[model samples]
Structures are given as structure tokens and as C-alpha cells.
Target: MERNAIILAAGKSDKFAPFTYEKPKGLFCVKGDVLIERQIEQLQEAGVMDIYVVVGYMKEKFFYLEQKYGVKLLVNNQFGKKGNLYSLYVARNYLKNTYICCADHYFPANPYLNDNPENLSYRACTYLSGKFREFAIDYSDAKVITGFNVGGRDGMAMVGHAYMNEGFSSVFRQFLENEINDFGVSDLFWEEFYAGHQRSLTFYMKEYQAGEIYEFENIDDLREFDSEFLMNVDSDIITNICNTLGCVPNDITDINAINAGLTNVSFSFQCGGEKYVYRHPGGTSGNLIDRTTELFAQEKAGKLGIDESVINMDLSGWKISHYIHNARNCNLEESDEQLETIMDYLHRIHSVDVASEKNVKVFDNVAEANKLMEMASMIKGNLKREFAVLIEKIDILYDAVRADAKRLGYGLVLCHNDVYEPNFIYDSEGKVYLVDWEYAGMNYAANDVGSIICRYDFADCQIERYFRAYIGHELTDDERRFYYAYIPISAYYFFCWGLYKGSIGENDGFFFLSSYRNMIRFIDVALESYGIVI
Candidate 1:
């Protein structure tokens, strides 16, 4: 007999707020496709033409889904008061010779049912973890005779889309008839009925790993599941999913060719008279969404302080942020005043009480320098041997200098961990905007000044003058020593970061190598200034 599939999607999913606040759990997407869409596709793949969705929460949203996907919708009126069994009972009329499944549980499409009825009757089960106290199973002959406290256990064979012969309705009806005076169906009904029937069977499925059955019980789980799914989704599938979200671009425009340090491809585009940057962090970083949101918040707060316009934010599975014009770069030699302005801007950003409230932690420079030493040790060939040795010397210098700074008790101040030229923006009004707040946090402020001096070709006098202005005092002998000391430390960090990027095929090794060479030159000059051997 041909089979039909019924999906139960009625729960309120209170645990997944903000994420599930506006949409039902069935509409949750992995990669680009919604769970309901995946479920439908799986059913279609299984050769089931007639599909029924039992929906209660956000039922109207599925109306279009039913029409678009050609599936029938069954409303569960008592969904709020009762549970899954009650929803099943309401849809019982459609259950004759049907396959029942839960809307939230994801499984691969496997159409071939066991031909042996005895074997087909089996239930999937597993031992529960200690923390998952709600899970229980009553079993016999590889089939579940009863189940209870089903939360947090993969123990109960998912029954939403279980195959049922014509006689299955009689069994289901009998189970419902014996329901306790309590309004909801008890967990014992299925066990009692299956045990009463001599033909029932059960089977334990393979344990779910990376690709299987990621049950979403909380927002964190949902985010993690989406990130993993996005990483594995095929390109064509991503296109379809983007189309479903109503944000797919008609034609690629201004590809930027610059990665925003995300997993997926992103580009700036104009849609509906509004300009925005559409980012597809396909799978590279799991925290891309959170990072994007934080950036938006920081930008808003920063703009307010400077009397600049607020940037509009539209975050999603794909990140979309405000598109800003590229600012002019100030000439390091001709624009000494501009350089000082930039330093003052940096000082203002560092002075702002942003990092402390956010609880941001800057990466340890000493630890980073040590990592370079380790990476140098791992190099195997003569061709890169000089570069490795150079890194080792730089690491040693950084360690000695950082130890001195700590001993002197130079108070930690907010520092921009990366103070490279590209990260500085000169607005048309000649105001300097320090962008890319990724590494902003509390640290030795000289580290920030040191990073800029090492990376950019600024005049030594201008550099000293800018530092003096920023800290509101002429540099003491110890302060100058500390700043010069951290120059190699910053260089060691950049070199290591570049190596790490290269190891991961990110194409940034050459930039780091250039910076490393510059640091060596700075080290010689600093030693001469300190009256130490060059």
C-alpha cells in the first residue's frame, strides 16, 4: 500500500527565544534550507506523494509552505494545552497506513522499509546520559514496548513518521481509548499497545555524530547546528536557500574580493533602494553572526560619540552591514599633523570605556611571540631556515622586553592590538577613524604605539611627538625603552599570525614576512638608541 507522512510541528519552543521568537521550529534553517523543507524533500525522495504537516505555533506561516510544496496542513488546536500525543490524536483520521514523524527531528532519506513486517516493527533506542533524567524506554525484542521522560535521550525511536498498516489505526485507536482521565496521552500507551501486540519489533540506530539528528533544544544548539550545516551545504543548495529567504542577489555586483574574515562569500549590493553589504560566511567561522552584531553595536556607539550617522544593521544567516565609502589614506611624510590627528583618534578610542564593559580580552603578545618560536622549530627545510631563525631571535627579544615591562609595573591601558596602516581611515573632513575593532582591549598602551611604528614608515621624531601628545606628557627614558621593546614583540606577533594564516591557506605569509624584516631593521635602530650592541 502507498504511504503518507505526517509531521508534528506544534510546540512553542520557548527555550529558543529571539531565534524562534517569530518563527516556528519547523522553519528553522540549516545551511540555507528550512527543516520543514528538508523534511518534505526527504519524504519526496522516499516516494511519498501525500505529505501532511501538523502545525500549531505560527500556523499561518506554513500556509504558504503547504501551497508552495503541495503538502496538506493539519491544525492542532490544543497544541498549547497538550503535547505530541494529543496532536497525533487530532490528526489520527489521516493516520491510516501513514508514516508519522516529528517536525523537529532530522534524519536522512531512507525509503526502503524492512520487507519483513516483524523486522519493520523495530524501534530505535540508546542509553541515556546521566544529565538527561527525562529519558526512559521499555523494550522487548528490539522494539520499544514503552517510553517515558523522553527529553535529552536519543533512546526513543522517533515515531512521527513511523509506518503504519491499515490495522495500525485500530491499534492507535485502542491506545487512545485507554488514555487516562488526564487530558494528554501518557508515555506508557505506546509501550502497552506494542507489548500487547505480538508482532511489534525494534531496532537501535547508529549514534548520531556530526551529520545526523542534531536535535535543537536551545539557542546555542540551533546556532551550532546552523553553522555546521552551512559548512557542508552544496553551492546549489545554498542558492535555493538564499532564494527562500528573499535576499538572493539577481546579479553579482562589487564583489569586493576582500574576505570579512568569515566562512562564506559576501558582497555589497543595492536592494529595494537601500544599499547594504551582503555577507555569506558559509562555514568558516561559527561566531560570524555574533561578531557582526557586536560590530554593528560598536559602530553605533562610536558614531554617536563622534556625531556621525548611525549605520543600519540587518543581520541574518547571511550578514548584511552598512556600506561605507573608502576613506583617503594620509601620506606618512607630508602629513605630520594628520599623523598626530590619527594618534589622537587612537587615544580617544583607547580612552573610551568600551573594552572594560564588553569584557574583551586581548591576545597575550608574549604567548604569540612564543608561538612563533614553536612554528619556527617545526620548519623542516633550509629554504625557510633563515626566516625561522629570524623569528626565533625576535621571539627571544620580545620575551626579554615583556618581562622587563611587567617588572616595571607599567599600568595596562586600552590598546589597539593591530595598529597597521590599512586599519586607519582618513575621512574627507580629515578626521581619522580607527576601524576594525577586532583586537581592541585593555593592555599595555605602548604595545599599540609600538605596532604602528613597526608597520608604518613614520618619522621617528613624529612618532615620539605623537606618543607624547597622546599620553599628555614627554616620554620618560623607561617609557621610550618600553615602547621600543614592544616593537619587536608586535612584529613577532604579526609574523606568527601570518604563518598561521599561511598554514591554513589564507595567503598572508608574504605580508607577515615583510613586517618581520621591518622589525629587524627597527631592532637595530632601537639597540643603537639604547646604547646596546646593534
Candidate 2:
């Protein structure tokens, strides 16, 4: 009876954040041995010598396993954007008589066995009372799994390791092949895929004693198990965070990656019983953000009661903000209920006195972008023609915008500067708060309007509607022209920003194309409005 194992080491879970940023959880050295390597040894001892390691999210680091353990590596390239079931889907052909295992789990003793090679089973452990968090299992009197739950207590909890006989794998392969193209199915894990169809299937629970199946759910668990956790001593992200917070690395716990912004990488962590988000500067971020100005603007927005509390921010673009829990970003669809509050916040934000901070407007951004365009070797090689045309019209576009902006009779003031959908958060109290002040500065309030419009690609009527709500007035010709002029300027600035970001390998795929196309479209419209050209 020949059997093989599929070790899922692909998707990177942020539950083990700073530790798993560069080194995947599979590679973590747990209790004097790497996690996945220990699993490999156990599987080999169980006579499952022929193994396939599904690798992604730093797959190159697993290349040594092929030489060291003689295991085949099946690479899942879309690992960052896809879920774990896709990993199994890639290894679907080899699921026969297979032990399906997760790479990050640990066991004090060998759990892999070939004695029950013909049985379809999932490993589980008892969680008695007091409300457990893992997937709880319900089984029939014959030891067959009948159902599973997410928030149940006093029952079997899934340990994420399973085995499938040839008959089960044969049918599962069909499910995998059929569901590969199914929408929303790729988001679930293989266990979840099975759980969805549990009524039609039978999986006997291989029950383990409580605490036998080990998973380090948090930093405290790892440190309690091993005081000399390398995440504290070796990780620079931890060192910088602790040094700034004036605490040791062990004080930080429950680290998770937040929604990664285009300008910054953020992660949520708990320290001193306070949860906060740490923003790490992303690629090309240093040149893009002036942190001094950002600090001033963010502090001002906070004072206005329209932003989260900032814990610490420095000149290097590293920042910590008080995390807003139970909140979601706006959809920015034309019909959203949150739009009125968001519009009110924008107007309130523009009233701040920013006389002390340096003003950064669309003109300044365009000048900075021109430098990025020339230095971008990729763009210089391919987009030279389009770049040349936009470069030639920069002066025309700026001059038109500047003249129209003068018609407003009020000078530039502070603004959120980048009023995209994700920058606005509606907390549980139904309060709309602005965030991500990296681009904030003393810019025309028109820039905010330009930002929301260009970022969301708003139509003419929707634009008119929001602008009407923003100003609370009828369409004044000068005000409309002023905003229309910013459309081209903002679009061009975004296009060049994309050029710079693209050169640094932060390729914003569709954003770059659409920004360039919109820049051309609005540039022509601005010129036509000025009655300068055809």
C-alpha cells in the first residue's frame, strides 16, 4: 500500500505577523526544529515517504526541502490573493491514499499513521465548555461527523489535518475540478469546502486527547512555551516597534496585518492592553510622503473629531494609530448611506488652520511626478511616446487649473488630500472618520473633490451631486470650472505616481492604465473648456 502526503505550506497567515512577514509560518523554528520539517519526519516515519509540498508566499525558501527531503514541490503562484483550498486544488491529482496536512500545526508526538489507510478521517480534539473559537465538530453515534460549528463549546474542534482513502479522493477530485471555476469557492479552505457538503459525505473523527494537537495562536502562547522566541530577538520589525513603544517585544501580542494601503503597509497589534495599527513605509514611500506635514495634518484632523487618535508618527513615515474596531470602509457606490456624513467630514476638514505646515497642491505633485517619470526605466523604455505627450501638456494643464482655481476667491487650506473610499471609516457608533493622512497637506479643498472623483471614476451627475452636497449650493459656473480643471491635474498626477510606483515594482495593474487614459481624456477636456484647442 503506497501512500503520499500533501503538505499545505502556501498561504501566509497574519495571525503570526512580524514572524511570518519574511519567513513563512511553515519555516518557523518551533522547539528546536522547523515546524514543517518536523511534520515531514513524522510523515516519513509513517511510511508516507513520497510527499508533495505545496509552496507559495516565499516559495523560494522551500527549495532546499527538495534536496534535503527528496519531496516534490508544487508551486501555487497566486498564493497571496488565493486561499488554501486552491493549494489542494493544485495537488488534486495526488490526493489518492493521501494524508492532507497543514504546515504550521505541531504535535508533541507522531499523529501520522498508515494503519487506517482506507478510512476518510479528520483529526480533532475536545474543547470542554467555556466557549471555544476553533471549528467545533458534531458527530453521529457511529463516529461519523454530522456537522461542524464556528463558535460552539464542549465538542470536537478541527485540527486541520485529514486523511482520504482512494474512493473519497476520487470523488473529491471531481469536486475540486468542478469548483475550480466556481465563483467565491476559491476563498474557502479544503476543510470548509468539505464542511459545506458535509450532509452528503461521511468523515469519521480521529479524536485526540485535549491539548495534544498544538497550534501557537498568539505570541504569548509561543513565549510561554519557549521564552527565547526568535521573533522577539531576531525580527527588526519587532525591535523597532518595541523601541518606539518603550516596551520589550514580548509585550506585543495578537499581531495581524491590516488592509495594506498603496502608500503604507499596516498591521494591528495589542500592547499594554491597547490595540493599535503600525504603518510601515511601503516601497517608494519615502519620496512620496513628507511625514512632518502628515503629522501636522493628522493631528489637526484628530482635533476636528473626524480622525482616529495617533499614537506616534515620525519623519520616516512610520506611524501608529489607535485601531478602530468594528468598522468597515465605505463601498463608495453612488447609493451608499454613508456619503452624506463623509461629505460633511470633508467640509469640516478643509476649515482647519494649516498656516504652520507647508502647502502641497496638485502643481507640486505634478513637478515631483515629472522627476519620477524620467527615472522610471520601465516607463522610459515602453511609454516614452505617451510620457512625452503628457509632459508637453503639463504646463497647459497646470495653467488652466491655476486660473480656474483663482476664481474661487478663497486660497488653499488643509484637506485629507487623498479622499478615496478606503480612507474613510464608519465606526460602530455610525461616526465617519478620515484616515491615512500620508498625502495630507495645505491643498485646495478642490483637491479632495478631485481625489474622490478621480479615485472612484465618478460620472458627471454623481460628481455634480457630491459637489453640490459638499458646497451645499447650486452649480456656480466658476466653482464647477475650478473642480473640472482639477480633474485633469489629479489624473495626470496619479498617472505619474503610478509610473514611479511601477518602476519600484509596486505594479498597480489596472490603476496605471486607467489613470493614464483618464489623464488624456480630462487633459483634453480642460483645454477645450479653456477654448485653446480642438
Candidate 3:
């Protein structure tokens, strides 16, 4: 005897509202298991191996279940416009003796628990004892279904599961075919067919006690039953976010890719009529970036009004913040007034009060970057020769910086380690906003200056002007020399960044390769000045 299960999950689930706006009702979790996953498990326990899911709304989410459970998916393209019976019609070929259920419904125990594995066909129902308000049934003296009264005085309610034997399957298929061919009745529910053909077909009604089954009619209903249902759902990130903000998934109207960093991807989205920025951290092999500390710094910076408004963040490294409308990435090409404002902005960031307990250090960043380079060297092909040369040059730079460290006057202050041109956003209101704090930490302030010079290619005059603007005086000999050498070191670090990112198969506008070329040029110039071999 072949036993198969079919789950009707093709309806759009518009009644569920906000929750279904971003995900299908079938994917929602009650207690610990996703709604459909629970049904699949019960079917399996009942000795049914082949499970077919009919999906339509947000069908892509079902792919994960298909792979994990080894079930087949049948798509109903007209799901958005059609009803549940259309989903069943699409799976007509599998009408062989089968068990059918709804994706959005959950049963505490299998109704087919003790039945003979291959003997009979029955419709699962429940007597009225709870909030279930769907089709109410009337049974004959022989315990067969006589008719259904939708939303009528409910003594027995249809619970969305039924078993069909080969004989019943053949009759149901002919009823559907005749309805489609002769009466052109394609929009009727599968249960409606049983009602219309009661003279020719009868179903044994197997009723369960109330509280044994549930069909979620809305998000509020589901939330009331299980308070942590949002978190139980595998799509916790999206659902928890929507619930906390008092907004639905449909409120998130647009998601525009803002920028792609070596270790993070950012996007701008509009939610509930307000714009926000979302940061999605990328995968990394080693501890290249500490997101915990990064979030800490971001919180501190937001308090100081140096960063955007942070809405929500978690250890998972995903963040949502307020989006500044009409803000442009600041560069040296901006008017002198704008550049000076950006200079003041950087100084202000350096001046922010550092929490004494935050033990985040600067060299931790270099250690992280070094790990990336090591991982890259192991993975990347044909770059061994070039990488070897870069490493040698970096070693020389490291030695020189260490020998000169005592006299450099490099202040250990909070620094935005990646202060490239795009990291600074200038709004039309003349307020300079610093963004992308992925590498922010307590570091030598000079390192940030060097990063800006190399990143923007600031002319000697512009560099001098920025230094004067920031320090309120001319640069001391020690400061000037340290800044000059630090430029090449920063460039070299970024170049290794390119190699690391490329090895990981990341292709964000060829960022890593560009960093490599800049590193070579700066290394040669800075090394020649120090009387070191190029």
C-alpha cells in the first residue's frame, strides 16, 4: 500500500496580515517547529514517506524544507489569484490513496494514529469547544458526512485533514474532471465537491476532541497561543523586527543596496514611512572583526551624535539604523567648507569619551587583518609570488614603525580605522555624518589621518591644511614624519584586505584588487623616503 501526504499551502494567507506579508503562513513557527514542518513530522510518524507540498505565496521559503525533509514541491502559479482547491487540483496526478492536510494547521496528535495502515478513508473533524469557526458538519446515522454548514451552529468543525482510498480518489478525480469539462466549475473548493455529490460519495467522519487541533486565523491569534512564536519561526530576524517596531512586513516597502564592504553589506530601506539603514555582516574565517565591540563602539558613537540612529542590533551582526536622506559620500572634491566640516567631525569622534571598561585595542585590528592575509595565502592561487613580495615589504614597514614607535607621539584614541572617502556622509544641511564603523576601536589617531590621506589622495597642501584645521596649529616634526610613514602602512594593510577578500570569492566592485595597486604605489614611495629598499 502506497501512503503519501499532500499539504495544501498554496493560498496567499492574506487573512494573517502583517506576518504573512513577509513570509508564508506555512513557514511560521508554533512552539519550536515551523507550522509545515510539524505536519511533515506527524505524517512521517504515521508511516507516510512521500510528502508533497503545494506552494504559491513566497514559494522560495519552502525550498529549505524540501531539501531538509526530502519532500517534493508542486507550485501553483495562480495561488495569488486562486483559492485552496486550485492547489489540490495542481496535484491531481497524486490522487492515489493519500492523506491531505493544510500547511497552516497543526494537530496535536495524528488522527490516523491507530487505524489499519492500509484500510480506510476518513475526514478529520472536531466537536465545537474552542474558537474554530470554519465549516460545521452534519453526519448521517451511519456516521458518514451528510452535509457541511459553513460558520453554522458548529457541533462539529472541519479540521482540514482527510484520507482518500483508491476508490474515493477515483471518484474525486472524476468529479473534478467532469466539473472542469462540463460545468467549467474550476473555482470551487475540494470539500464543495463532496457536498454536491453526497448521493454518490460519503465520508466517514473521524472527530477529535477540542484543543487537539488549531488553524491560525491571524497573527494575533497565533501570538496569543504562543507568545514566543515569532522567535520560534526560523525567519526570526525579519519577524522579530516587524513585531518590535509595531509594523508589518508589508511596511518595509523597498530595500536598496547601499554599499558593500569587505566584511559587511549595507542596504537602505523604507519602513512605516520612515527610512532606515540595514547592515548585514558577511562571513569571515578568522576573528578579522569583532562585531560585539563594533556594536559597542557604534552605541557609544550614537550617544555622542557622531553616528546614525541605531534602531536594533544583535550578536548575529545584523543591524538596523536610521537612514539619512539626501546624504552624499564626502570626498576631497567637496567644497573647502564641507571638507573642513568633515575634519572637525573626525576630531570630534577622536574626542568622544571612551568607556574605561571597553578594553578594545587598536593592534587587535592588525592581528585580525593578518589572520585574513594568512587565510588568503592558503586559498588564493597564482598570487603566491606577488603575495610573498607584499609580505616582505610589509615586514620591513612593520620593523621601521616599531623602531620609531617611541618618538612618534601617536596618541591612543578612538579611531575609525577605515576612514576612506565613502565612510563619511555629508548631508545638505552641512552636518557631516561618519558611517561604517566596522573597524572602529581605540587606536592611534594618526592612523585615521593617514588612512584619509591615502584614501582621498590629499595633496601636500590639503594634508597640511587638514592637520592645521584639526590640531589648531601646524604639525610638529614628529607628527609629520609619523603621518607620512603611517600612510604606507595603512595602504599595505588595505592591500592585504583585497587579497583576503578576493581569496574568499568576494567581488564587491573589485575592491580588493584596487587596494593592492594603491598599496604597491604607496609602499614604494614611503619606503624610498625612509631609505629602505623598494
Deviation (Å) of 216 in candidate 3: 21
- The best candidate by lDDT is 2
lDDT of 1 by residue, 242-335 (tens): 4534554333223233343413444454545555554444332442124543354346436535213234323344444554566566664576
| Ten contiguous residues with the weakest lDDT in model 1 | 200-209
Each model's lDDT comes to 0.57, 0.75, 0.71
**Number of the top-ranking candidate, with TM-score as the measure:** 2
Backbone clash count, each prediction separately? 20, 0, 1
Off by over 4 Å in 3: 1-234, 239-262, 265-273, 285-287, 353-355, 364-366, 382-385, 456-476, 508-511, 528-534
Candidate 2 ranges beyond 4 A from true positions? 80-82, 113-133, 148-151, 195-202, 216-233, 253-259, 268-277, 282-484, 494-531
Instruction: Report the lDDT tens digits of candidate 3 across residue range 1-534.
Output: 768888998886656544464588888878877889988988887778799999987888898887788899999987755556677788988987788888988876775565545456788887775544577788878778888875655488777688888788888878776665345255666777677887777688887776788877766577768877645555554664576577765465555565456676666667788888766665461246667667777876777777766777766677887777688777655467766776666787788676674566564334555766677778875454756777677677767665666556445677778876777776667677777777878776767776766554456687677666656778776566556667667766676677676675665233445455556656766666557886
What TM-score quantifies how close candidate 3 is to the native fold? 0.56
Q: Please give the lDDT score for candidate 2.
A: 0.75
Candidate 3 collision pairs: 498-512
How much does candidate 1 score in TM-score? 0.45
